[model samples]
Target chain A: MSRLAAVTGIGQTQYKSARKDVSMAGLVHEAAERAIQDAGIGWDDIDAVIIGKAPDMFEGVLMPELYLADALGACGKPMMRVHTAGSVGGSTAVVAASHVTSGSFDRILTVTFEKQSESNAMWALSIPRPFSMHLNAGAGGHFAPHIREYIRRSGAPAHAGPMVAVKDRKNALKNPLAHLQIPDISLEMVMESPMLWDPVRFLESCPSSDGACALVISNEKLASEGPNKPAWIRGMAMRSETMTCKGRDEVNPLAGSDCAKDVYAQAGIKDPRREVDMAEVYVPFSWYEPMWLENLGFADEGQGWKLTESGETEIGGSIPFNCSGGVLSSNPIGASGMIRFAEAARQVRGTAGEHQVDGAKMAIGHAYGASAQFFAMWAVSSEKP
Target chain B: MRDVAIVNYRQTVPVRDSGPVNELQMLEQVIQGVINDTGVALEDFDFVCSGSCDYLAGAAFAFVEGVEAVGPFPPIKESHVEMDGAWALYEAILKIRTGEADSALVYGFGKSSPGYLRSVMSLQLDPYYLTPLWLDSISAAALQAAQCLNSGTLTEADMAAVVARSRANAKSIAASQLKGDYSVAELLAEPTMVSPLRKHDCAPISDGASAMIVASPEKAKEWCSQPVMVRGIDHRIESSMPTLRDLTRSESTSIAGKAAGIAGVDVQFAELHAPFSHQEILLQRALELDDKVDLNPSGGALAANVMMAAGLDRIGHAASMIQAGRYTCGVAHATSGACLQQNLVAVLEAAQ
Candidate 1:
């Protein structure tokens, strides 16, 4: 194929339950401007703009890209809108990178945003079609049973869930843009919080937020001229499988494993645990940090919760994951996965402000969607692959 | 850019209420027919991409089951878009451009019969300002049509003529649900289903699927001697608010077509997925394809608009004409979201 692509700029918004100050288009523009600033160029330098978000139903704006183009300085450029469920953010980034990799565009701007406050996701997701069953349970209900299965399979301590919630929230305090910041959060606070779904307490669930993420991907020569040093895009891969069947492994999903394997292979790493310095995973619920940890092959199956209990996922740990608070602390649904990816690049670039893990060389970014059946992951490094 | 050309194209007979075959079955039959017509094995293709929506199937990731159509024993490099197959075709070409694959197979299918197609479609609008009100797709389009009529952007006579011409064209095609020749006065005699948009003015909820094969320039020469060359292609979107955009014309289509080299073509035929007759006029104005272009020779979406796939079929229909040696150059158009929120235009030519 082509040589490779690198990420020269990354930006994320101050995620919140409702960004009432800015409109949906405004939220995305804010992030795009930040990324442009970070890249040390005006919007005129951008060759093409690629955008994505979850379903059009989420924000009540069908193909919001149409409304967002001018705001993001994409008036005369070819802007491609992509929709691929939750991993849309990562998919959008890949599509932008593909244009660069295909020798079409030299520098591409990719952005994904979700203004969840614009509509009720619980109700929007439950728009009863003609023949489908109506369960207004939303995301928590859709994924809780799977958490129960992970608990049963792992046979981990009950405190593992609370432990993860406290740690990730505390990490959020270090991240100014993270959506949630619980002042007095602790293991006890998490344990005492009202359970929204069994095993998923109120403190554990991600807040529906209004936020956006943006990235500027460029060729090697172009990346060298960025405002801050760019993180070389080592590898990117995406995988999918049927959402349901006779035997679906929610805890150790095949799609997650397959996606990880492909991404790791592309990055030329046989042992992800040893080769990767850190990771930023899509964890809307606290428990998924461990579940996806195992699913991502960072640890053996059923032992991922042990990584959480051991405090290994926090900063300074051997494999520090979600140093930028992750989706658990700031989830704007469609933009969450891409935020993970941009955060990973930040860590590698040594530009992660307060949340930067020390001297991190290579980092992994992961995102999953649709009952954990779709997975997209990539590796970024201080050194080019 | 990768030199991807349309090598094979096929579609099922559009039916108002097709029986027995589910979405997957329809996809398989049409995709298999495409492969058979091409004289190529299904596994010979290096990549497969599909386009479809979950809302139409009453579930999520509706295109997953379509893998059975290709019989994926080899674990193909595949992807699906929650859009029309034309976009999927665009992505597949990108893959080929990146040197990731050679030839690719693409398809899209939807059965709107199971659901309140129009109501489900309303979910595509901005949920906060519009969907909470539960505005069905027909009423929304009807409102736009009424607004168009009131402003003298389109007349009732003009709308009727579009219906009459489409039905007249549909009679010659075997795979059409609504077909008949009628005068403008006869259509005006019918009662209104939605004000300003009679039943004849809107397209039926068609149950159909379509498939197309694309190969790089080298592979296309090996597969088909007379490949329909995709000369230029591009898509664009306008604003989301209905009032903000001009309902009478599609600025987005005009921008995309001009960007895609549509203005450079000596257009011989065209297929614009209007759905509503009035939309045809708007699309025509946007593409600037006047009397010189023979639009919707395949009866167009006015006869059968199968949501996501219908738009892709527009591109395929135009390209098929080029392959049949009927046109030197042609234009195809596909629209998405409400009132043509997004538009894709492809310029195709038959190389001499």
Candidate 2:
């Protein structure tokens, strides 16, 4: 028999271009302390600490968790650093929950961050590996061709990307911690923005930000004793495939579909669109919103764009998404995924102040990384399974 | 918790440099080699986890390229850690206990020769306080050695003897990076490379990869002729501040060892990830290993210090010994951060 796990508290730093005021330790500490305080517990309540980040090069610090141990109140406790690229945030939370499910620890503190301001992230990401392509564009450049293929395959309308960008920015107006809160966000403004990667406009892409996210996860026993209502973790799953494998579809990735299937199966959900009240999907690019919709089984293949055109993904719609502005409005790289997970929990707990989906019963949190090969996702609900 | 056992282990010969071979090529060889030893197909493993540092490769998402080694075509359940492979093993064990996976493939690799290992490791320190001072790893370790010496907790002879035994025991292993029949007195006579620590006192900078196959107890018995069961495993961390920790002793290791139930076990041999000579002594005392324990039978990291892979190598080496019937029970240790701020201890026993 496995022990149930729940998210008792969630915290995140204000996303920004540069967090110059705080060092890496201070940044993570800020989020961790908030989560502890929100949980109404002291640092001693945490049994272990798990941290995740995209890469050490982003902060020019190799395994910054070593330095962060003291700041996180992790001394004399077990600590592990996870690095599964952008999906690290989701995977790190999954690992923390698994520790509780394994009956090893009662309360676990999990955190993920990326201090992009510390170093030039574009340069760090574009470093030429031996025997690989040298004249490569950064992450956007690598994904542009794939976006073009997705457009070609789905035959999405020209206005779909602009429409999704405008929707997320509009939603950002409600999230005070969001990095990009454009007051006059509109489809016309997004279409007028310069195109950086052929079909993907500059406004459609996520901004580089420095931020951290933290969660206080506890076993069922401890969770029952917590001060606030808990978001019960229904299911969690992670999957990966090679960057270049035979017959792999980068547009509608198979790894992502498999991950969604596994997570939904674990949660005993047959129809995701009807069961999942809201979703906090990782939409780094505006176009990804529709593409992921089909991959996640929210809509049939070649029909996801219809949902976007109908505006059903907007707040107060049938299936609201990016209620917390999602990645397009604020991308802290590693913390982006955890922010989505946290948003899902917040909505379920009825604590999502401005952007709360009314009476959200179940929510989905998803993230992908590394040429869309790695996928991590989880399902959280207000009611225990 | 479910019973898990390691059934197969493999590692590349540690060398000063891997040249233009690259991380993917090195990892592929170990992955294929471990599969051959186990006689099990890659698709049979329920999960995969690897340990690597992208900083060593001078690129972000460098570990993503490592997926090519396993030919992840249909996709698989997997995870990666920006730490030593031993921690990856720890995660895999938890996956099995939680019934997430019945088996897992754990691997780690690093090429430290391309960059100055000491200066590169300096980046791992506290950036605001230590990195600004540009304190390299050797100097940091030398400070630890100086404190131990000044406190009368260790001596030059004790340090030299550790290196001498490592050299003598490692001479027969083909994967040994540095080995010879040297006397403790001769090692002591050599000029100190950094204060009280000599060149031999530190582990050599090596490039290598290691892999192991682990499965649940029932699956292990069905798949392998010999299996080494993971009896207990635990890890603990302390302050990153070198000044705050007791340099003369490893308090974190003691806490981890006790949590792993290292006490009252008939551990005949041990494999420790101690890159420095004094550290080996410090760890032995912390874990309460007496003279009966055969320390560093494979010369430990002193024989082949392959950064991210060495910690996993210690666990792999210990499991191999148990498989060979040379030892019925043993302990394997892995550590990270400055002066062993974090430590993982795993107690292994041969299947009866």
The most accurate candidate by TM-score is: 2
> Model 1, A1-385: lDDT tens per residue?
4557899988788999999999877888999999988888889999888888887667655446656766787754667777667877777777778778877678989999998888787876665543334545887888899999888888988898778788888899999998888878888888898999998999988889899999999987798766678888888877666555556576677767877887788888888888899999988888898898888888998889888989888998888988888888998988988998899999999988898999998999888876676677889999965
* Candidate-wise lDDT, in order: 0.82, 0.90
Best by DockQ: 2
Interface RMSD of each: 3.7, 1.2
- Give the DockQ-based CAPRI class for model 1: acceptable
lDDT of model 1, residue B101: 75
Error of 1 at B298 (Å): 0.6
Per-candidate chain B TM: 0.97, 0.99
Candidate 2's residue-wise lDDT over A103-190, tens digit each? 7888999999998999877787788866876526777888888888878888999899889999999999999999998999988889
Clashing residue pairs in candidate 1 are A60-B126, A60-B127
lDDT (Cα, tens digit) per residue for candidate 2, span B1-352: 7888998988999899989887788898999998987788999999999998888887788888877789887989999999999999999998888887889999999988888889988988889889999899999999999999999998999999999999999986778988999998899899999998999999999998999999999899888989899999999999999989888999988988899888857989889999999999999999999999999899999889888889999999999988988899999999998888899999999987
Chain A fold similarity by TM-score, each prediction:
0.97, 0.98
